[model samples]
Target: MQECLGFYAWQGNWERLFGASFPQTTDQAGVAPLLSRVPVVWFSFDEAGNMTTQNAYANRPKGWEKMVDACRGRGIAVDMTVAYLDGPKLEKILADDSITDRIIAGIEREVALFDGVNIDLEGLGSKSVHQADSRTLVRYNFNRFLNKLRDRLQRLNKRLYVCVHPLNGWFLGYDYREIARLSDGLVVMAYHYGPTPEPYEPVEQSVTLALASGVPQEKLILGILTLKPYEIPETLAEKVGIAQKHRIGGIALWKISFLNEDFQAVLRRLLQIK
Candidate 1:
């Protein structure tokens, strides 16, 4: 069966069937259906990869364990997602081995409360690392970084996954082949074309390109943004069809905090289709 993942964001106050919440509830009776459909919940810790000096234990949001238990109670695997979008800063961290070592150490510490860690370090591959050139070196070093981080997480028996930009997109820092080999899976963020009613061809092309780059379909997870204004059930199902057509490993919703009845309805039907 293809996996279905829902990203549980920490930034939003969600309105649920029980009521709106500041500390959103995932284990509620109303949310059980959505949580049950999702095999995994990617907890957005709002942490960074470039920040090497961090205390993961002390940094958790209040009542983090209970929140995690809520999802785990439903038999869902909860993984932590660490993100860094600053291009220059990420490039610098990738260029220097010492910097990456610290970053990896910091990430390893953060995963103790998680089943796995998904690194979302953006702004590389197509961009320069130390200078205005050398995109190849950026990919080389990133591959090395993933290799090291994967080893560290493996020692802890925690899975390693990378949230990557689409291969057809502008950013080229991710070496899909090497990353596929290093990480357990690749969550391809395949949305954001321009306006509402985004094109699905790009999503299809991204999956195709990833496969062409030698990434196995089983290791690919198509990441779709469910918060878009035009993302109705019809549009959402089209994206799911792309993943189904390609036989990818699974699909990841950008977040579950914004999940309304409409989005949940689409997922219920779409996920069952596969």
Candidate 2:
């Protein structure tokens, strides 16, 4: 299968990006200059309230239709992200069936705007303390929500995708087995490993977990981060290359803003050498 590339960006920056193809407002355009060329784009937005103080793409941006149209002209696919974490509001919403319906309905409406939906439910409730006991509950409820969401998307002939972070205390509540079974494919956010107490290849961790979860290798999409503060030290970089040799599936970068020349070049070399 041909591997895929995806770029994450706020919806508002669409115009500035079009500048790379400046002076040409046509359907085919822009600075798609980067390693592992992205053919799909993922956009995250806050719903119902301002979840993040940082401004996100306004629910929908003007001219996105034209922009997506332009991308589709180049054979690119566009997808949207929906995040639901455990919190007081989530607790209240899940406790009340009617409330959950209303909230999910709203999410479905937002999801309908794109070709598919990517669910990012990391950092929900406390995971460290109840990782073992809460794992099944979290997975069960998550799957329930997806089943409902899937029904809604099916009516619109839309696809569903899931974004999973690498093993982190925050996501200990997640049951990878059930999640992989429910999701169409997994977008493993595998780049945070190298930024911790001891740096390591995030993709390598993802590969191990993905295989352990019994998630089909073809259904796994290795995720990379354009962000920095990373120290590869020659040895680990070579190990990373060996990990990528497995060719599990596609690859996607976290955000476009985090990418720099040096980072991009390293990724290019990895992909080329792989």
Candidate 3:
């Protein structure tokens, strides 16, 4: 199967994603070089579970459409991520049946502008205290929401991707097996443990655990962080090798703005990006 290399570009880092020039010290002219190798780019410009308001894409950066069109022109898939900081909004939406249509309408409107959607519902893990019945309710409602969203995307002929934090499903209360089954794929966020970053051990363990949890390797996408002050080119390279060795679906980097010359060089060499 073909291996996918993906990257995330947040709203704050729109300059790096579409900027014409980059720091010369980074040995990079612009984002063009990186786009050649990356098949998918996830843009986190939409607020999570806030579909009641006007479409977020309407406020996108100037030339946003041109940028997306440029990406598409290169055979790259531009996906938007809908992320929730906490579970209350998501929980509230899941609790109410009447808002489902509105949510679906908002998503459809946004999906029409992109290749697909990535559902990133954070802060809903099992770390919090909840009664057995409440937990079951949350899980059921969340699953229902996903199923509905998946159905909508299917009807539109668009892809649906989900994000899985570093935590295990048992702790997060997310059914990864079912999530993998419901969406096009799952992005396993394997970074952001703490200030003092370790080598590739944490990522390897996370990937291994995800696989053990019944998430198919083929449906898994390993997510790595590219924040500064975490110099571990060798470790990052090793992780890429691991992903390839395991034959997982792909490898996704956290953000494009943090990428420097060294980092870009490493990625270009390992991923063989022209």
Candidate 4:
């Protein structure tokens, strides 16, 4: 089995993630038991690349620090994600040198608590209206920001992971080969594809695009949405299967809260756990 990275989302009002309704999984009692099963946990504690405030400080989940410490103590690689989904704003933020410097410095403070950081900047690339890659300015600024971030993380002995839109999608900002060359790796958010909530064609095409774009198969982590409109157990299982079939780096589940009974059963069977 490849690496299974679970995004532990408890940021802000959980009901509004990606502008969809989901049961508030942050405060659920059942989540305790599932904690031990996760091999790697990506902490999405609500960061928006803000220059005015440290968003993580206000939005972090209760006991999140302890969770990070405990996960690392268990030998699990715990990382954090900072997201900002506005293209215009994100492009502007990246375009400013002093602002980007402050943002990177602020991120360092949060990432020091984990194994690394995942830059979850969306919108910037997805705005090109079904074009090839990100806008040239967006591409240039974003990569430059990554370059500086990569250097900062290197000094802190932390890894940098970037979450990107699927190359097959209309979202444009991602330059996969360029991003792969600049950072440690990438998580392709190939979640909204469907003929039946979780079909396989888009994923196959995405993995194909990333590889053909010169991204190493081993460094590409396939990220998929496991809940919401996921009506059956096979939906989640099939998504994971695509990554395994391609022999990519791993699979990243959108969030862990939806690992309720039905999905847990599916997970156990796929992981071959007793």
> Which candidate number maximizes TM-score?
1
lDDT of 2 by residue, 54-103 (tens): 34322444445665665556555566665554443443344455555665
Worst 10 residues of 2 by lDDT: 49-58
Give the TM-score comparing model 2 with the true structure, all chains together.
Answer: 0.73
Local distance difference test scores for all models: 0.70, 0.54, 0.65, 0.67
Full ranking by TM-score = 1, 3, 4, 2
Q: What shift in Å separates residue 238 of candidate 2 from its native position after superposition?
A: 6.1
Per-residue lDDT of model 3, residues 128-228, tens digit only: 66656776777777788889889989988988878777653334656677888898888887766655454667778888877887888888888777665
Off by over 4 Å in 2: 11-60, 84-96, 194-198, 201-203, 231-243, 267-274
Q: What are the per-residue Cα lDDT tens digits for candidate 4 across 39-99? A: 2233222224443223432235555556565555555677777766666667777888877
Say which prediction, candidate 1 or candidate 2, comes out ahead on TM-score: 1
Worst 10 residues of 1 by lDDT: 37-46
- What does candidate 1 score in Cα RMSD to the true structure? 4.3
Candidate 2 lDDT (Cα, 0 to 1): 0.54
TM-score of each: 0.84, 0.73, 0.81, 0.81
Error of 1 at 218 (Å): 0.7
Which predicted model would earn the best lDDT?
Answer: 1
